[model samples]
Target chain A: MENVATGEAQRAAELPMDNDAFAGFYERSARPLRAYLARVSGDAALADDLMQESYVRFLCAARSWDGEVAGRRYLFRIATNLLKDHWRRARSPSIEEIPEELFATSPDAARIESQFLLGPALAAMRPRDRQLLWLAYAEGYSHREIADVTGLASASIRLLLFRARRKIARLLREPEAEGRQGRAR
Target chain B: MIPKSCPRQSEVAAQVLRGQWPAGCVEDLRQHVNGCRACGELVLVMLAFQSARAQAVSGPAPVSAGVLWWRAQLRRRNAAVERIARPILGAQIFALVVTIAIAAILLVAQARNVPRWFSWLTQPGQSPGLHFEDLWSSALAMPVWGLMLLVFGLAAVAVLGGFVLFSDRPRQ
Candidate 1:
């Protein structure tokens, strides 16, 4: 146990020495990153696991970035790759099997209806579409930032976001159309 | 989808979604969208989708960063220890296999020679050249079971040494 502690101390020393800086960074970024992971992968547990792994990997990485913006972009890129790798290694859940929290019930009728429409609407899209749309729309990431984070071409983001928006809008309206059809019947 | 006539429709919609239009370009973007039905619909849908997505992913994180950092450190330490112990484990298994093989061969050889040696000993008139004292000083000093037990004891000691060397528990 003493030897292990010594070795761990040695490794910790070798890591980035600014714990306060890293703690600040984690505080600023962890929540949004967790939310991004949960929304993209549709699993809260997986999101938490991936978020920790992403931070660990970020700390271990050797490259340098200019500022917090660049650092954040790089961290997100690492996280995106990790998510892709995970899906490759395991059998991903179908859209219907996405976590229930995404479509949680609410007392307010409008909020409940929006949640109902939004959860499955987002799920029905491709993972890449969901990632691109969420980052662009929900997170307010600019085209270049999304490109940096997602490894997509900056020129392609506009068209892709457009299509993703269209698809989600169409999906959101599908339930209402179904209800109208039921009323007619 | 953008109309064939509006090549900049996607770009305008993307800029609007990101709130990245230049200060002077805002009115141009607005006028362009107001004049183009496709661009107008695209803007409205983008805004609505952004709102829904925000609501979908909003919540508190499951675990805090400090806890995650601690867990990551533990995992890394465990991995390092495993890396150091893997070769020791391989060597232990190799030594055990070799020891068992040698013991098996010795047992088979002794079993085959024991009856012949006993017959030779029973014939008192025949001089076998080998003296009792010499035989007693050599392999015959102990019974087969005793020799086997000694070999097993040595093997056990080697295995125990290996276990101490390659134990999963961290050394103090």
Candidate 2:
């Protein structure tokens, strides 16, 4: 592991460190990456930290990537692994326990409503399901891109995404159905 | 328009999200979404989820690129320092242990000689005829090479100690 880290560091040293190029990359990807981390982990602070780490690690990665899209996908992969490491090292809070600023801060009424409807529903689902759904819907990543970021089989994404969508729809509807039933009573 | 299950549901949804649906198919896709309850619900939820994620991430990043670059540089420098220091640290520790062991052996030998030397000194009228030449020829006399070794060992230990102490000091 140490050797691998060292070798990666050497490779990073050899990679371009042009400030202009890096700044451009950061400007393009930082916000989306932060949002992805925040949505997946449901922690803004952790997202912020992981955002920086992902960029740093991306710049320091041993392998070279071809284009911006590939680089961005690789960055997401690094962020996912970092999140997994965080989970392995420490017990993470459930989605419901995530701070409100992560999902509830938007001033737009429609956005707020969507977040209100989706946040808890997302929190209620497994992390992997949330990841798959978010990558599919939110990030607009295709099955292959999702597979790349998630380390999942590309063949399985469609089925998994379909299942996840159904689950989220059920979760979103359950409260309304209960409320209607209560009103009738 | 509302089939029970379209095989192209996932593909259509993905294309809609990407804003890449063909112009000719947009009307048909819209009709299908409006007519099909399951597809409509999926599209609605997916769009809502996408909007919510966009809003959630719309905030500015906490730190800028320059700061991140500075941190990366700092990390790289620290790693480089550690790489250089590791072997030196190992060597210093090894030298320390050997010096301590040699010093300990010398102390024990000197301790055994102390009582005999003291007894010899306290003996009355026993060394009146003993001269400086006799003392120089005595078995207790330290050889030139031995004296040089002791001096060199002490100096080496002191220099190494100082080097270790100075190098281990915390940097600002």
Candidate 3:
């Protein structure tokens, strides 16, 4: 541990963001990023893990962003990619229906289970639908920004967002009234 | 489904996200949200998600920024070193292979002369100068291709090793 820290200290001169600068960025972005991850992934523990990895990867990226907004977008991009990789590796295709039992083990897990009121309402929806809705409405991302963060085609974001909003509105309109909407076009 | 988006939807949603809907919002825009389906749904979705976000962020405080910063710095440095080491590792293996090939070729070339060289040393009444001459000839008897190949191989290994070790392409 001592040797690792000492070696890191020696190479610290070459790093882009110093402790204070990274701390500022981390403070400004961490909560929102975690919120986005948790809601999309339906897992608090994975959200925390992915959030840290996203920051580390953002720090490691070779290009410099134009400003703080760009940095935040890039951070989201990293988080999204990490989440995609996690999903692929875990082989759980229906992430929206992430089992309640999965979170029964911890306090944060329990909080996540209780916090997302709309989660179970639209829990059967596709992962992409949850991601698009969160990025669009919750994050206030324009269609273009949502496309950028989620790696969807920009031209398709409007239609996708519309479909996602329709699903959420119909589902949230009444818990008992779900799946009665005549097959949506 | 409306093919075109309602511009007022953005205004209403933005206001709601800022938690100033209806109060900070003008009466005219508030009425527009009530009438427009897009804007109405946008308000409901945004409000629910806004409350959900509050609950989510309030669940648990993440790790401290200082810890994140320190760990990121360490991981980034380690990744950079790993990136640079990959090509160097390849070059080192290439050098080792070439060195072994040279040793094998040399062993083959010197095998025929080994007994003569050993007997020349064991022979009595011969001057040390004749022994030196035989050894020199034995060295010269190695094939020209073998000699040139060894020199070329060593130079290639040196060049590749130097390039891979010195080039500093950072990991993304």
lDDT of 1 by residue, B139-162 (tens): 675578768766775876687566
Q: lDDT by residue for model 1 over A13-112, one digit each (tens)?
A: 3444256667777877787787778768766678888988998878766455457877777888889999888876666564335443333322343343
**Overall lDDT per candidate, in order of appearance:** 0.67, 0.70, 0.73
lDDT of 2 by residue, A103-138 (tens): 432334334444367766665566777788888788
lDDT of 1 at A167: 66
Among these predictions, the greatest lDDT belongs to 3
Residue-level lDDT tens digits of model 3 in A1-185: 23444464457425576677777887778888998887777676788899988887787676665678888888998998998899778877555466534422245554545445587654545667778888776777888998899888999888978878877887777754653443341
Measured with C-alpha atoms, the lDDT of residue A1 in candidate 1 is 38
Pairs with steric clashes in candidate 2: none
The lowest-lDDT stretch of 10 consecutive residues in candidate 1 chain B is B53-62
- What is the lDDT, from 0 to 100, of the residue B4 in candidate 1? 35
Q: Candidate 1: DockQ? A: 0.20
TM-scores of chain A across candidates: 0.73, 0.73, 0.77
**DockQ of predicted candidate 2:** 0.25
Report the lDDT of model 2 for residue B29: 76
